[model samples]
Target chain A: MIVDSNLSFLQYCSNDELKTLCDTLTHDNKGEVRLSEQLTDNDVYLRCYPDNMKGMWQEIAAELQRFGGNTFANIFRGGVGASYESILRDVCKKMKVRIPSCSTVEEIEIALLTKYCEETIGSMDIDLLHELSVEIGIKPQSYNKQIVAAAILVALRRGGGKVLAPVIYYIGSNISRILIGRGVYLATAGVLGRAAAALAGPIGWALTAGWLAFDIASPAYRVTVPAVIQVACMRLKHNSHFLTAQCV
Target chain B: MHPADAKAILALKKIPGFNYLVRKYMEYGGESLYRGQNLANHVKVYEDNFPALYRVFKETVTALGIDEPELYVYNDPYINAYTYGETRTFIAISSGAVETLSPDELKGVLAHECGHIVCHHTFYNTLLYSLVELADSFKGIPYMLFGPLVLALQYWSRRSELSADRCATSIVGAQAYQKVLAKLASGMKSFKPNGKELLNQAYEYHDIIEGSLWGKIQQNCQVAFQSHPQLCERAYEVDRWSKSCRYRQSRIRVC
Candidate 1:
């Protein structure tokens, strides 16, 4: 007659009833549960439960985040923090939830706690609880092979953003710089042609002469053309936007 | 002898799931000295690797109601942690465990192990360890595959996690323990976890957790393959417990 009095969930077991339940559980042949890993550490539950409850587990996340985490630095230093048992007992006490007796630590009180959270807190508790349920062993999860697949996808995609991006930026900036330099080159050539025209005294003949000599060989042309070309090159060298388009 | 009904194991072992693996992995003799030889290589190495963990160990004994004991350590990738010894209780920490948890999360880990200390869980743990080994050694193959044997061990393991979670909540705030749990849940699932999503997962899985055999089975299956509760599961439960009315009834349950 093993019966839980306060939890409100009841089951009456006769010898045969007990035998059937025991046999079914022991030899269920359920490959779902792993053989090696121990299940002793899973005894967690909602503080107290009600048959029907209101709010879904909305604040669960906030609760987890409340205490936050310590830096790696802190743990190595062996600074202060309370023990797990004390934490469990204290939390239940503070929340005004019933603390289980020593007898209960080895019982199904854990499930009751989880149920309470789900029924009362609803999706939030479930969502929050999901974070606690490990993928292996007994929780209901259809082990997606794709997590590995996704990880593979992510791994394959690594460094693409950084590596390919810069190459494109360099090329595009140069291209844009060169495109913009066309106007400057043409204007300078015209100016040289006009000046040559004045020096040679004939408009058409002087223009041809300037085109052949000053515009082609003069220091201004040498300096300006190369500088203009370099401005395009500099834009190519420094401009992030042009670099961005190429990478994509 | 009833596989599920180990009076000694239930009374003695501190962390819940200890019996199952200790029983299963009983290739070595059941001598405390067997673990003793492993101790120098085991516990001390972790102490050197994680200096802060050693400090936590010292502080736990100094804590009220605690009597110090010798420490032990083992090498395993699983996330199991515990405390044991007769009069001098010291905590055993694993390298895999050290690598997996954050410092605060690690603090929760240590504190939970400490819970076994003051509660006299180590003595029970020693007792249960023998009981489980006896059942397995005497009963042989059928019992090994039997569900009752599996269930008891599973139940114990899950309970141990809760005890530890309580330990953490007591030392820090329940919030910190929850945060650590949430992280464990997330880490087990997708290796990469956004903090909020992990919290959300902890809440989502809250429904199936139960204290009964079926619930234990579900919980067991949930954690059988895992070394610890899913981070979200740990976090969410911590949150629920911290804010829980049942939890509040216990004095100093939260920091």
Candidate 2:
């Protein structure tokens, strides 16, 4: 099928614009069918179950008893479809509705998405994964230098490896304080070259782009210019030499 | 390789945080980021003030068989404009500048911007800015060396302005340009003076352009370290070139 627009399945759709989209992508076009954007195997059992972690864990435990499925790898290893990561705490807390202290990353994920989801999970979406990760309080921005530096100090106390880049300890603090906005943040001008080197791919793009938008050097003509100029200069020299000889 | 494809590849290798999106984009081909809702959602507010200008921009594109160019605004004071090169081009004019000039002047500025697209300048800039973001990333380099490189980029940037100026002049001929310049001379030059005397001042501007040796020196003095040639200089340059032996023979129809 021809790709009609930039948005994937929901690119053009609203939360309620389901009627407008064709059901060719659906395994069952009937209104009875639904797909969770999570990973699930038992589509039928998935439909009736609550989506919390407790419900998920109950489903997982029941499935284990039913099919002898009893390994951490067996459940968590399958797919990245479940929004289990987003509501991990909610899932565990929801499981608390049944039993207490049943909490772990793997259990929370598998319980919610693998067994608890009401419909088969749709394809994996990285954005949803990131959002889920955020929900679990795994803030990515806090992973910059100072946090690493503090970790290093703790590491040094426990006798870890030598500090590879100690200067960054002082610099990252300053960078965190100042570096704002999306453009190049001069966290550490000292390591800027290194950062720039790291950023070579993007910078190279900017250079090439800046060059093209700003510099219009025709390679075809670059090759031709010197060749043509050299020939023309040679003829001019020859004529000048002849004129000098005639004058003499 | 085509510049567009080549830059896309380069952008993938570079632009660190954007790699994930860029790679996914390559795997599943990305399409133009336009939708019909773009008009009523964004374009409607612009219609409130300049209703006629807004109508012409929206309806004329479909009527004239040209795709509607995407528009964006960024706040900057110094006067500058550019066009984006993509599946179709998009153009934007800053409000800081709009507040500075008139309707005719804005149209002339946009026509000059359109000239860049017509001349295919944006394709190169898209590549160049991508590289600039790359070069800009390399912060540890000695300023002694890197400083000159950036300055040179900027220096060349100033030269490219001259090239676009030619395109601007061509699209909006000397007649329209003369009116625009007069309006600018009155508004921009903080002075209160004679009326007919200023129109005759074009002769003085012309003299500064194609003048005696002293006049040439004065003209150079006026434009030194200036990225754009002054309005008088632009008028003079166009006037001189159009009157020259070679420009008359050009088939592109510039007067």
Candidate 3:
């Protein structure tokens, strides 16, 4: 029985029960979960988890709730880690919502949680949401936060739960490492996106005229800097969402 | 040094009249012209002026066990740095680079320039720099004549950049060096980066380069005239070297 120290509800289970629960978690309701053979030890989840995990995590969380583990059961379906309060604070900050300094952590958490759920996308910071939307391949017709958020949610459903890993990564959210570890989503994004990403644009060339404007000292950088910068953009684009499969 | 870079240097050596061209370029005071031009145009950094940047440059040079070269900052909005001169080598950074890079990233840039110096690349690099200027200025007849030489120099120059990146990575640690690379790729406004993400991207790029014939042709044609390797390839090379026995063994002894 491999117990994850992070999930506190494991403490409620007796030794025998823990063994059974562990078996249940690993096996799902089916037989042994067939993980991708290519998955390293770091990624212990099922390979078919894009569909399976969503349904299965809910079932397990419900079972745990019946076992009197309310806290673990109420954990966000987004698979955010134990540092939910900090991540919520980050989401609030990025969304530019003010948190009262006097408010307790729990109060602030609940307030922000309500705000995150109840507020219209229009009330959210347009720039942050737009930036995040573009990053995850959501192209809503309008900049309304709700519309954009809805688009992202729809994309998440269609693409699988891991589709928003980049957005979470960008916003500094403590999304569980388990989500990031499974990289097949981007790997399967297709050759065209990969090709466009691998061959970065001439960002360096556009900056060159400004770089060489002075023209007084023909520093050897006239040879290297813009070219190096060009290469850097290539690396950056190759790594960023540009290469990821269009989840939307 | 990367095997590709070593091979490129050998190919450049094999080019006809390559040595003669470098000799003639050097004999005509090609290096001296830049010293005067830079002294007049760029701000020289010493103990007093831009002391912080000078300290980083000095420290980087010392770490690499190389002679201290004069440091200069040229006014420019684009982030860039380069090593120039022969008998008395010099390294120059753009004002934009100073404004943008963090202290450690600046160290990585300086270390890269210092690496070029340590590797005895400045003299030939100066000739290539001059040839590019000459070709740009006289695009008709002289450009036609210098085409082969320029292509070969560019080829070697790209590989040399990989070697220099390795030197910087070894000195500043791969993480900071990668940040510098990422910053150079993007601009200051979008400076945030995860090193592993960048490496993963680089790996994807390498896959394209290896797996697709069209990708190889496209990349070769794109970089044919440029004086640096594709950034993703450089990042990929640097990341791999950072994890290699050579880098590990060196660090162990240094520690």
**Top-scoring candidate (lDDT):** 3
lDDT of each: 0.41, 0.37, 0.57
The B-chain TM-score of model 1 reads 0.60
Q: Which stretches of candidate 3 lie over 4 Å from their true place?
A: A1-248, B253-255
Q: Candidate 2, residues A20-65: lDDT per residue as tens digits?
A: 1111111111121213212122332233222222223323323222
TM-score of 3: 0.50
Q: Please provide, for model 3 over A53-96, each residue's C-alpha lDDT reduced to its tens digit, 9 standing for 90 to 100.
A: 32233333333322222235335433222232333344445445
- lDDT (Cα, 0-100) at A206 in candidate 3: 18
Lowest summed lDDT window (length 10), candidate 1 chain B: B1-10
Off by over 4 Å in 2: A1-248, B1-50, B55-68, B73-80, B85-88, B126-152, B181-227, B241-255
Q: Per-residue CA lDDT of candidate 1, range B6-48, in tens?
A: 3334443444665555644443444354366556577553467
By TM-score, rank the candidates, best first.
Answer: 3, 1, 2
Model 3's lDDT to the true fold?
0.57
CA shift at A89, candidate 3, in angstroms? 74
- Scored by lDDT, model 1 comes in at 0.41
Better of 2 and 3 by lDDT: 3
